[model samples]
Target: MTEKEWNGDFDPMADPEEQKTLLSVLDSLRSYRRLAHFNSTHVRRQAFYSLPSQHWTLLSQPPFSVLDSLSKLDDLIDSNAELAEAIFLEGFKAFMAPSLDSEWVASIVPEKYAHDEYQIYSIVMDHLNVQTTQGDMDKARSCVNQFYREWSAEGNMERGKCYEPIINALYTEFTARSQDILDLDKSDLKVLVPGAGLGRLVFDVCRAGYTVEGNEFSYHEIMASSLVLNHTDKAGQFNIAPFALGCSNHLSRADQFRTYSIPDVHPRSLLESEGTEEKVPPYERMSMATGDFCVIYSQPSYKGAFDVVATVFFIDTAPNIIRYVEAVRNCLKPNGLWINLGPLLWHHASRIQCSGDENEENNDDLKYHGHIDAGVGDPGSVELTDEEVVALVKHFGFEIERHEPGSVETGYISNRKSMLQNTYRASFWIARKK
Candidate 1:
């Protein structure tokens, strides 16, 4: 459907905070549509040298065959561009539909969320083209990478390393806590996954006979996940080249250009063995929620609401680690389990920067301050050592039933064929509310 002109409208939402968040997500998804351009620009710049540096002798060198190699490279880049476009386009179509902007945003606000004066901004895809930034491109790239990491068959190796222990540990906790579903329509067993990137882990947990909610903060991720979790019709229904935009440390060019058929298994077929397709037979077990992990789960409504709180590759995102611990403790039932698997790669500890209108912005406001690298003062992150985090967990009324430090080694969205690989020796832990 054709988009109505933006009119630069500043429509008001009942809740200003939620309105701001929705706009932020919309902005992120809109920028995603420009992914092909961002990557092509980078690939071309990396593959070519300055014209001034190339003299006739060098250009015409017989052994090198510069033109021949470049000709082939150009062909590959073309393929890469096509693949990148397809990946972003397919992932974004559902969310970016013009109808979604008005309907979804307008419906944002339930009762009890209100603002006397709310001002929210909206950006159409055409306007996003004008406002695209390197940051937006970086986020777009992450969305593509998440497709493989969360849904593709090739990503199973890494997912196994990071996700298996949580599943197994939860199994022990679920059996210990609740013997039967409270309601046939609704399972008494409830699991909450924080930092639930792309909803894959939530899907897995839901398949284990527990109702699970995947909560995420990144709009790019929310859009990407919602696309597949809801829209995909069959196994391997979506295809993407996650590594196509990469320009460094490749063992072979083929590695970077490889295509992946996403979601090796159909989400609907979660429990084939039981004859029921979904873990919750009617597909009611799996759910997705979008917002800050600390803010959403810390609410009164969520207190003691979950049988298990699972964090996977997520704790390091906290500005203050204590807030994370508090929120987890707050939401779990007495003797509820908190299972975690991740490296403490403190996401907020990046070098700080204050630029332009952002000079007054708080460092914890990751939308602007995240990867920028200038400025002085504190980076505004409370980064804890592995030991510190473990002790912190214990301090917050959790008994260390299990703790395996640096045990699971895995990569996030890694190219298996890349010569240089960055893998994390993630710690795995399961603690009970004491």
Candidate 2:
């Protein structure tokens, strides 16, 4: 057992007196190693420092300083252990505390963002984890549906509140860059926003006079974005030209209103009659579309077709980076542009797999360890190094245009203190097709 000693200035290899002090310090560190339960290898390392006169001069400083530093490190570990225990105890109390009054539910959520019906229902389901009755399930569903409706309405009302600043920043950056490559005033452009969460950026592009449509996979996200788009002042700014809004079910149904009569564009899918059967109306199909941009590479669509594609916080979430890049390539035309922003941190493999079997233990050993809401569905996550990411994009035949830090504030959000620990940092890049 080595116990570390704190000698103000004990040199390892010096006069006989200094050697004695260094030996004593090494002995103390050895003792502390045993007391602190450090591994046997650490104890051996400390014991090596105890040897007299041989490797004394090799040490960077007085051996006593190293010993003292080790002692302080031990103290830090102990303090961290205590803090973790306290946090665990507090979490247990919060989890097992007595049920609150049902009326207090409203107070639990902030008034501004309180209408998350599904979230509230999820909380209720979590509270009642045991097998539930049909009635209870139905009630939960109703509560969640109502919450969703209210949340949608609330988001519509506050569409431009906090989101506007971020969107405006993105728009300003993108518009300025676009002007450099294309004639913004003269060129007729079409824009597509994939994974268009909230669609705020889509609205911004539309307002800039480009024909734009948002493509989102999630029903909830699309609905939320639609609500915001419908209610925001910029709704009218959308390119209402007949060629902008493609032939789709929504547009066809909207055609009853004279104001909604748009120019006829090719339907994404066509219906065929089977052996003299009645002809069916064409149905809308979702596929990546492309259009010309003076500076087209920013958009991810068929090569040589689009001027630019804007992707924010998107690529890092794909489980298969290679496949994701391929998809981007398929969407962009030759000489098209791809613009991106957000953290470049690779997501954990579990998140990308969508296996739902991920637990805290599994996450502990991950390269990018972080906590998420317990019941949030498996989020597709991935993390890649800058070189790897660039390689993947290059493999798809795109050349890097510009890569730099984004201006957005990101990382763990805390009311007390912000922790900007970046295993992987954020980057903004504009790539162009060869």
Candidate 3:
């Protein structure tokens, strides 16, 4: 494809529908551009440049066409920018891919997605000879770090967009179905939201009139969530730029960045009541904790401490799913309600070594620090289906009170452009300890 055709086809300005998704994809791929620039300049510099003297030649090349083979991708992009979404989608899938095992690339592709992606990105960079400006690199680094912090279930357009949807689901279960499912009312409830990313659900649960404590293992998430929980007073406004760019088919929103806001979680008691004199802040009893879920639950103080365990977007995070079942079984008081949500997407089930047990001996502690890793005994572990999970919980002395399996629309980063809605089936259930 000619440069003009490529430019026109990939431009995000012309199409309004395509602008949002494209810009979001571009925002996600910013770190990659920076990484490619870094790789070109520092590691394997010779591979990216024809010769040191030819650096000027590389600099003179068009930004998008820096690589000769780029035309092939450009042609594909020109043919259909929507189809070209995969170019950035697959390339950075690991960074922003949905955590659902059913939607996992390994289920579709025979090989590990990350392994293949690393090579594909490397080759693309070699062809592009991209040079990342120091300022741009710094911004890229910041963006990358933020994405890493919000990796699992934050920053993504759907997650941000679906925040209300998720809350709606929980609200339904907590209120409409409370008596039928958990055999309890929602008032004065003590909730423990394990694997609470960004503490959204935790705060929401509190707003729903429950005393909540969110337990998280990731330091980045804990810090990010704490900033909102502690720093921001009730009803206060706070903004965080989780992504750097929002490039689209046209460059219209290509440079458009997104800022995810901390939702206003007012203390329930703060609302003015008719003939009421006293008002209490809603989050007065809410708190956040940082520690391994299994370890924390296994602790003497935590065992049988919580009245409810809302493992939303969690449970599948364990290398051994049985451990989570056991942890929930241990921590929850007798007949305590366990409202489990989200798909049975095993975090360890992915083709990549994203997360694992850190308790393993001689396992590279550093490797599992930022990203989840399948510890020494991990890697190649099989994920259990929802049915299996239900049976396992039953074996662990819990009776399933409710089971509703359904699909939900979700996507990483933003989807302002494409009307494409990525959906995954999730197992929603409430199990009670016998």
Best by lDDT: 1
Candidate 1 pairs with clashing backbones: 151-263
lDDT of predicted model 1? 0.64
Candidate 1: segments with Cα more than 4 A from true spot: 1-35, 38-124, 127-130, 177-187, 269-282, 350-364, 367-380
lDDT of 2 at 305: 48
lDDT of 1 by residue, 1-434 (tens): 00210111122233544344444444544444344544554445455554556653476466645555444444554543333344344433433443346555445543343331111122233333343345555665677667788888888998988888888887766565444544332256688888777788887876666787777666566556665665567888756667655557876656766778777887655444442644355255567665556666777988998888999988887767888898899899998889998998886775455665764344334642122222112245678899999999999899999898988889888887888889899998889898
lDDT score of residue 119 within candidate 1: 17
TM-score ranking, best first? 1, 3, 2
Please, what is the whole-model Cα lDDT of each candidate in the order they appear? Answer: 0.64, 0.39, 0.50
Q: Candidate 3 on 1-434: residue-level lDDT in tens? A: 01111111122334543333223333334344444334433343355465565774765476633354332323322222221222344423322233225343344444444466544444443343344334333433343334323433334444543345445545665675466665564544567888776666676666555567777654334434544444445442434333322223423223323333433343232322211321324544467665566656766777888878887667777767876787788888886778776776675554444335653322332223222332213354458888888889889998888887774445444434433445566667778788
Q: Candidate 2's residue-wise lDDT over 254-280, tens digit each?
A: 231112111111111111121123221
Q: List TM-scores for all candidates, in order.
A: 0.75, 0.38, 0.53
What does the lDDT read for residue 410 in candidate 3? 51
Worst 10 residues of 2 by lDDT: 1-10
Q: Assess the local accuracy of residue 407 in candidate 1 as a C-alpha lDDT between 0 and 100.
A: 88
Model 3 poorest ten-residue lDDT run: 1-10
Q: lDDT score, residue 307, model 3?
A: 76
User: What lDDT does candidate 1 reach at residue 3?
Assistant: 23
Query: Poorest 10 consecutive residues of model 1 by lDDT?
Result: 1-10
True lDDT of residue 198, candidate 2: 44
